[model samples]
Each structure stands twice: as structure tokens, then as C-alpha cells.
Target: MSKLADNLNTILQRIKELSELNQTSVRLIAISKTKPVEDIIELYHAGQRYFGENYVDELEKKSNDNLILTQCSDIRWHFVGHLQSNKINRILTRVPNLDCIQTIDSIELADRLNNNLQKQSKILNILIQINTSNEQQKSGIEQKDFLSLYEHIKLNCTQLICQGLMTIGSLDNVNTEDESDFQVLIQCRKELCDKYNFSINDIELSMGMSNDYERAIQVGSTIVRVGSLIFGVRH
Candidate 1:
């Protein structure tokens, strides 16, 4: 088969092996941000239905492309980037088939997206991004504010569905398998479920990337955003 397909299979096999070892089922999201639509189509044809893009304009353009529309209609687009409030309407309007957004980090952003989705009578699935690394530059809610944002969404934002939580682990500790961040997320999920009476199984944890996904799966990451490992490094 094609090189891309082969590469995808290798990554999937690794994920499968790791998931089996960890006794956890993990869903893979191909992060296709800067990659071409052709590469996306190749992976899609190879049975990859979930794809992620970081930029709103790129996602809008790619999702609207005739090639994606005709050939990969079943492809699920995920907005896995720091979504600015101004661009929310454009994204909602342009990418109709956009599936899950895994970067909701604030009540204001969540409210804005919910309001935009309300206009279209759509309930967008969202994951609250947690800054587990506590890095100043990272775009996620502080551990303290996670529940406040979640509660705001649940209480006020009717058009947004809170699916779970997401986090980008510390890049500095990538090789060490420092699962402190993952542990924080797991504990947060457990607390939320116990305190709010939410279903533990319903809350998904979106953590891990190309470097530390195996550790993430071992600690109960339901969705893993793998990019370079499957698609090769972006130029």
C-alpha cells in the first residue's frame, strides 16, 4: 500500500499494542493541521475517520474543499487548537461537519461557541483544556478554574455539550514519562464524577501526543492526538 497508509498502520499497531497492555481503549485523532488534504485523504481511505486541525481558517478551507466533500465525506474534523473568540463564528459557519472541539479552556470562549452553535441549532461537543503542566505559555484553564468553566457550561451554555477534559503534558518531561499531569486529570475526573454525580464513563480524557501517548493511555486517556508519528514531521 501507500507510504502514508503503511505509516498509519504502524502507528495504529503501536497504539493497539499499548492499549492492550494498558487494558484501555484509546481513540486516535490524526492531527492534520499543517498537512495537506491529500495526506488526510490517504489516511481517511485507510480507515481513519477522525482528523484534527489547529487553525480555524485552514480547517474551514480544508473542510470545504471539494475533494474532502466528495471523497472523504465521513471524515470527522476536530478543532484541536486554541480557538479565538472572534473566529468562532467563522468556524461554526464554514465547517458544518466539524465533530469535536478539544480545546475549550474558558467560560467566555465556551459561551461564545455555544452562542454561535445556537444560531445553527447545533450542540457542539467540547473538552475543557487543563493546563496540567502549569506552563505560562500554554493555552488551558488553570486546575483551579476547570470546574468553574465546566459548571458555567452546564448551567448556562445550552448549545455546548461538555464531553470531557484535555491536556498537553509538559514538553520538558516528555521522555521521563512524567505522568503527574495525567494523574491530575484522572483525579479531577474522579472528583467531578463524585461531587456532581456525573458519569465517570461519560467523561473522556484527551491527553497525549506523538511522544508520550503510551503513558497517557496507561493512565486512562480516552483520546490521543497523534500527529508526526503517523504523518511524518511537518515541514
Candidate 2:
């Protein structure tokens, strides 16, 4: 088998082992931003269907390419970066098969996307991004504003299916397994589920990355975005 396939399998196996111990199923999103299409195809052929891209233009090009559309029609594209309001139309129009936007952090962004999707008679899946780390530089809704934004989406954004919550764990807290950010997400999920009369298991948690996914899974992360460990370092 190819090295890329081997790496992909290793990550899957690790996820399986971890999830089994945690008694929760975790979906793996291969963050393919900045990587060549060839590499993405390699992983695609190896049964990796969920791929994430961070940039709008790159995702548009990759998803719109005749080659990729023809060959990998089943590939699920995820937008895993900060999304701007102005680029919403560009993304919604260009990438017809975008499965999920994992960075919806504002009521305005959610409203725009919902309005556009309503025009197209489409329903888009989205996750509310939380700035669990409270970093000034991150592009996520603060904890204080999370519920209001979530309520706004649920009430007004009829075209959006609120999948769950997503956040990037604190970089400084990674090595020690602090997972405080992750814990915050878990608590939020529980609180939201209770308030909404929804099942806790149904509220997905899109946390964790290459460095701390295991810890994330242990704490109830339903989705893990892994990039470097599977695709090798970005150039």
C-alpha cells in the first residue's frame, strides 16, 4: 500500500481504538487545505470521503474542478476555516456539494447563508464555532454570545441544519492534556441539548486536531479534524 494510505489507516485505527474506549463514535475529517489534489485523490481512493478545506477559493477550485467532480462524486467537502460574509455567495454558488460549514460563528453569517440557501431551495449543514480558548485572534463566537446566536439560527435560519458546536483547542494547553476548552464545549453541548429538549448524543462536537484528537475523543468529541498526521506536513 502507498505511504499516504498507510498513514490514513493508522489514523483511522487510532481513532477506532480511542473511540471504542470512550464508547463514542467519532467522525474523521481529513483537513486537506494547501495539499495537492493528487494527494486528496489518493486518500479518497483509500476510503477517505470527508475532506476539509480552509480557504474559499481553494475549496471552490477543488470542488468545482471537472476532474474531481467526475472521479470523486461522493467526496464530502467541509469548510473548516473562518468564513467571511462577503464570500458566502461565492462559496454557496461555486461549491454545490459543500456538506458542512464548520465555522459559522455569527447570526449575520448564519442569516446570510440561510437566505442564500433558501433562494436555492437548499438546506445547508452548519456548526456553531465557539472560541473556547477565549483568544482575541480566533474567529469564533464567545461563550457569552453562543446561546443567543444559536437561538437566532434555530429560529430564523430555517435553511440551516444546526449540526453541533466546533472549536480549536487552546494551543498553550495541548501538551498537558488540560482540555479545558474541550470541556467547555462538552458542557455547552449538554446545556444546549437540555434546553432544546434534544438528545445529548445528537449534538455533535467538532473539536480536536492532529495533536490532541485522542484527548478530544476521550472527552466526547464526535468529530475530529485531522490534517498533518494523515497528509504529511504542509509545505
Candidate 3:
């Protein structure tokens, strides 16, 4: 097997092992930001279906690229970076087979996503990005604001699916056993599930990354975004 495939297998095995202990079913979103389409094709051949991009244009070009269009017919693209209000239209209409937007932070952004999706006659899955660490630089809604944003999306954004919550953990917490951010997200999920009258399992948590995914799963993470460890350093 190629190194990319080998690395992917390693991560998959680790996630399986870790998830078994926690009784959590985990999905891996391979972070493909700044990486080449060849890398995506290689991993796709290696059994990776969900890939994430940070830039709107990059995702648009990649998802429509001839290589990608021909090769990765079923690949699911995820927007995992900071989404600008202006780029909402670009991402919604162009990127084919787009799966989820994991960085929505506010009701305004949710409103934009809903409006654009409605124009396209589509409904896209989304994860409300939560500022679990309360870092100034991070682009996520605060825990207190999360409920209102979620409620708005649930009630108003009919074209958007409230798939779950996503968080980019603080850099200070990476590689550490601290699951404080995960705890904050758990509380966020529980609150929404209680208010909306749904099972907690109906909502998913998109947390963890190459640096601290194992720890994240120990607490409870349904989706882990891994990049360098699987695709090597970004190009």
C-alpha cells in the first residue's frame, strides 16, 4: 500500500480501537486543505470518502476539477474553515457532492446559508461551530449563544440540516489529555437535544483532529478531522 493509504489505515485502526473503548461510533473527515487533488484521489482509492477544505474557491475548483469529477464520483466535501458571509453563495452552488459545513457560528451565517440553499432548492447538513475554548481568534459561537443560533437554524433555516456541533480546540489543549472543550460541547448538545425533544444520538459531535483525536473520542466525538497524519504536510 502507498504511504497515504498506510497512514489512513493506521488512523482508522486507532479510531476503531479508541471508539470501541468509549462506545462511540466515529467518522473520519480527512482535512484536505492546501493539499493536491492527487492526494485526495489517492486517499479516495484507499477508502476515504469524506474530505474537508478550508477555502471556498479551492473547494469549488477541486470538487469540479476534471480529475476529481471523473475519479471521485462519490467523494463528500466538507467546509471546515472560517466561512465568510460573501462566499456563502459560491460554496452552495458550485461544490458538487458537498456534505457538511462545520464552521457555522451565528444565526446570521445560518440565515445566509439557508437563503442560498433555498435558492438552489437544496438542503445541506451543517454543524454549529462552538467556541468551546473561548479563544478570540477562533470562529465559533459562544456556548451561551449556541442555543439561540441552533434554535434559529432549526426553526428558520429550513434548507439547512442541524447535523451537530463542531469545535476547533484551543492550541494550548492540543496533545494534552484535557477534554474540557469536549465537555463544553457535550453540554451544548444536551441542552439542544432537551429543548428540541430529540435523542442525543440524533445529534453528532465533530471534534478532534490529527493532534488530539484520541483524547477527543475518549470523551465523545463522532467525527474526527485528521490532516497531516493522514495526508502528510499540506502542500
- After superposing candidate 1 on the true structure, give the runs of residues whose Cα lies further than 4 Å from its correct spot: none
TM-score of model 3 relative to the true fold?
A: 0.97
Sort the candidates on lDDT, descending order: 2, 3, 1
Using Cα atoms with residue i matched to residue i, what is each candidate's TM-score against the true structure? 0.96, 0.97, 0.97
Better candidate number, 1 or 2, judged by TM-score: 2
lDDT of 2 by residue, 1-235 (tens): 9999999999999999999998888999999998988888889999999999999999999998777888899999999999988999999999957999999998889989999989999998999999999998888999888989999998999999999999988868767768799989988898898889989888999999999988889889999999999989988
lDDT of 3 by residue, 140-228 (tens): 99999998888788789999888999999987987688888999999899999898898888999999999988888888899999999
Which number leads on TM-score? 2
Worst ten in a row by lDDT for model 2: 170-179
- Kindly give the stretch of ten consecutive residues in candidate 3 with the minimal lDDT sum: 170-179
Task: Report lDDT (CA) for all predictions.
Answer: 0.89, 0.92, 0.91
Clashing pairs in 3: none
Arrange candidates by TM-score, highest first: which order?
2, 3, 1
